[model samples]
Target: MAVLIGLAAALAGPGGTAHAAVPDSPAVTYTNPVAEQRADPHIFKHTDGYYYFTATVPEYDRIVLRRATTIQGLSTAPETTIWTKHAAGVMGAHIWAPEIHFIDGKWYVYFAAGSTSDVWAIRMYVLEGTGANPLTATWTEKGQIRTTWESFSLDATTFVVNGVRYLAWAQRNPSEDNNTSVFIAKLANPWTISGTPAELSRPTLSWETVGYKVNEGPALIQHGGKVFLTYSASATDANYCLGMLTASATADLTNPASWTKSQSPVFRSSAATSQYGPGHNSFTTSEDGRSDILVYHDRGYKDITGDPLNDPNRRTRVQKVYWKADGTPDFGIPVADGVTPKRFSSYNFADRFVRHWEYRARIEANVSPLADSQFRVVTGLAGGGTVSLESANLPGYYLRHKNFEVWLEKNDGTTAFASDASFHQRAGLADAAGVSYESVNYPGRYLRHYDYLLYVQTPGTATDRADATFHAQ
Candidate 1:
């Protein structure tokens, strides 16, 4: 596992030509495990300027929620228990995987629960909130959804496409071998399934059938003309991973033939990152609303004594999601713990991203093996709105300027080192949507790559500005 160290470092000395003092404006950043023992995480940013969060508590007894103005604020936000399980009837035991959503000016919570007599007989249920704020709203219990069979069902999520609302979930078909499969159906309303359910995907892949044949926790996100449904598979242990299903945005969502499943898992456990059994993920935009962030839960340690559920270390974590050239989402490896970072892809050359080769900054093809290119955008050494880039693969080393050249080096604490490491992060001087790194010491000079080598240069034309522009992941 990669050790997470502090971002604070000593300022460089005189004539060192690299490090500078830490910035005055605190860096806008957040760490992983926003909350502890919170699994099956879900976060949504509403128009009211708050990011609401809910997840499966380790006890699995009730639904709790929290909201904050910023993503980082959720860590300390007070939790509110909006609803509790029934004492003996249907919604009585094993309350799990609660997701809160606002629909038609009201709030609805879709969750899985089981009867007290039959604790394992889990099924989906809903709670309608009547007030404006979900935390203070009155929740009315909606009964279990009747599916094709009274079998095991859970993980209900809703989304709208074009003008139609649909519900997607996981269920055990009577004819199948006790394996959970993913299903989708058009919604009559927020809590009811209007039509027959269509089985979108089954646990047929080898990875999906690992400890147990499973496919659950369906999350939907639409882009362009494609509907992306991501789900968790296998047992809820180290074997747990994420799989994806895709369908056309205009396709009949109730038709089983319309959806296509991936042969392998899209996201999974990473021993190097100290995150095991990483699954049941949700998606939301960044605080800036310009990037898509993946929210999920995972065990911090690999080894567990008894059942993985009892371990209770499945902490909620978040990371930025990137995109491929073909427009498909690229959820890289589960990152190592600490502050997750981003990659800067050149605007002029979209395929090339800024990376380090032998401690020297360079532009390389942005491909599958992405760790080398990822860097943490930390507070710059020089104060006044400047920022520094710290390498993801090589911790403690940062991108610093020396002799008008960008170099990845270990901060040795010197005035020159501090001055060279600081750069003002700004909107792309060329492309408004893109970004540019202007040197704090050199003033108008910006970080740009020529012949794949990074250097500080003054831009005088559109092409020069384009060379200095980059799309940060």
Candidate 2:
């Protein structure tokens, strides 16, 4: 985690270069565990210009909600308990994973609950909210959403594709040995399933069957001509992770054959970041609606005492979701705890990003510990309306140019060091859409990667301009 040296150091611009505004870029800084003790997190950015948040509380006794205009505001947003579980019958115990959605101008919450008598007999249920503000809206209880079977079921999420609504969830098949499988069905309405559900994915891969053969928490996002369904797998401990299923947007979604499951988990626990059991994710767009954000929950520690379900340490977190050249989402890894950092992606080599390896700065793709590539774009250390790049995981260290070569070095609090560390933010030399960094001391020299190594070089050709230009994301 980077340490703040002064007020100016903390006063960085939000997620873009100072010269030009980039629409829909991520916020400059947001602390992790956006909401504490909140698991199975879900975030819904509605047309009302607010981000609605819901999750399984540690108590697991009621459905609660909160809203904020921005993702950062959600951390301190006051929560309102809109509904509670029944005493003993249906929707009575283990109230969990409540996801609020707006369907056909009405607000609906899809959640899972168990009977008090049979605490493990969980089933999916719904609640309807009457108005624009779900926090203050009149919520009416709508009974359980009947699936094909009455056995163990949970984590129900809904989405619409080509004007047709579909509900996807996890349910146990009595005939199968696996704990649960992901299923999808057409939704006649927000609270009712119209036809038989198709089993899209099950836990068969080694990573999926880590502690238990489980597949649950189905969340969908349609992008790059494909419908991507992501779900949690394995037991809810250090082994818990996320798996994905991909299908063509035009395919018959109800048919299992349409979806192709990834052989490995798409996202998983990152020991380097100290985030364990990272799964059960929801997606929301940035305030500008340009960047996609990954919202999920994980514990800061790896071990749990007794049952993982009883542990209350799981906390809600959010990070920007990157994309691959192939147009698929690149989750990267769970970042280190601190102000959420940004990765400077090369405009020319979209796959490569600014990273530090062995204290030397360079641009590389798929760097390990990901924190090595993440940097806090803070206000200038030299105080000249410039910016300084601070290492995300290395406190007090920054990217400083020495002998024209950029290296990760600890702050020495000297004028020369500060001047060497600061850079004048400039609009991209090659592409106006991105940004280029000019050295504060050397007026014409700009930061660029040569042979994958970072250096301050004066641009003389188109290739140098392309190499100097980067998108801060």
Relative to the true structure, how large is the alpha-carbon lDDT of every model? 0.82, 0.86
lDDT tens string, model 1, 140-250? 987787788899999999899989998999999989984799998888888888878989888988899888999999998877688889999999998999999888999
| Clash tally for model 1 | 15
Report the alpha-carbon TM-score of model 2 versus the true structure. Answer: 0.85
Off by over 4 Å in 1: 1-29, 347-351, 356-360, 364-366, 379-388, 393-447, 455-471
Model 2 per-residue lDDT tens digits across residues 1-473: 11112224232333321222342453345678798899999999998899999999999999999999999899999999999989878888999999999988889999999998898999999999998799999999888899888899999999998888999999998889999999999998899999888888888899889778999999988887888999999999989999999899999999999988888888888775688889999999888887888999988999899999999989999988766656677676676666678988766565568999999999887766566888888888999799999887675789999999999999999999999999999998977878899999999999998888899999887667777888887
Clashing pairs in 2: none
lDDT of predicted model 1: 0.82
